[model samples]
Target: MEELFKGVADPVRREILSLLRLQPLNVNQINEHFGDISRQAVSKHLQLLEESGWIKIYQAGRERYGYLNKTAFYSLKEWLDAYLQWGEQSLENDHGVFLEPTAYEKGAPLTHPVMLQAMLSKDKEFDGLFYNAVRTTGIFCKPSCSANPKPDNVTFYLTRDEALKNGYRACKRCKP
Candidate 1:
């Protein structure tokens, strides 16, 4: 558990994980995602991730492909589930309304204003972090969605189901 925490502690490592969440990539491909970091640094991060069981590496002829080992995240998820339950209990007791925890509330960083700016700017790096749901249009879209809506009229959601539950449909453009 401590190893897992250490593995994901760095922002670079987290970004690597985020990239892997989308699809498996070779070390060179992963290194290309970061302009500031050297290939050696990325390789070291990959080694840590592999050691911590957060990722698995396999060779495909000349290239070594790294894929996210999602099962390794289960332990972290279990730990967070306890806190989520506590939060839900606290909310239920205080507000008299049960509100299920959203994915963003669990661990996503999309709640930050900077992340909102990233979404508005169509930053592809944050594509899987959250979805923008336009209240007026009743539609949800990916961060890179081509459809632009007023920021005031948009609410971000952690999942498509959350947006759908709130009466927002998936946008045709981004297909959230």
Candidate 2:
């Protein structure tokens, strides 16, 4: 745990982790993102991250690519979950209603195809997982909403806030 903390302590290392989250990249590719830092410095940071299990390096021919090792952060995630549980309890106490947990809370992958199928089938199982926003009508609905729009005209959002942020209003029927 100390090693993990040390690995993420530097801003440069944190930036590297952020980059890796998007996709794996070789040292040269990673260095391109930072104009001021030398390749050697980035390499050193990579070595520390690898040693701490924050990243895993793969060699393709002469190039070494670093990929984010999400499993390595299980301990860190568990630690954060404790605080999230506390926050949920506090919210419940203040609101007099327990907060409903989303699939994201259980580490379910949010995929478009899965969500689209659920919406098309009116699957109530995915009601809280995501919202279906219609591009043509500019309205978002719960997955089980009776209204069905053409798949091509619909886009799925992880949250109602995300749909609203993209200029979609809640469906009058679903009240999403």
- Looking at model 2, report the run of 10 residues with the lowest lDDT sum: 91-100
Report the C-alpha lDDT of model 2 over 100-151, residue by residue, as the tens digit. Answer: 3553344578777667767876867678789999999999999889997999
Candidate 2 TM-score over all chains jointly: 0.49
TM-score of each: 0.50, 0.49
Which segments of candidate 2 are over 4 A away from where they belong? 86-176
Best by lDDT: 2
Model 1 lDDT per residue over 80-136, tens place: 776566444653233222234453353545555644665666866567678888888
List where candidate 1 sits over 4 angstroms from the true fold.
86-176
Distance from true location, Cα of 142 in model 1, Å: 45
Q: What is the C-alpha lDDT of each candidate?
A: 0.80, 0.84
lDDT of 1 at 142: 90
TM-score of predicted model 1?
Answer: 0.50
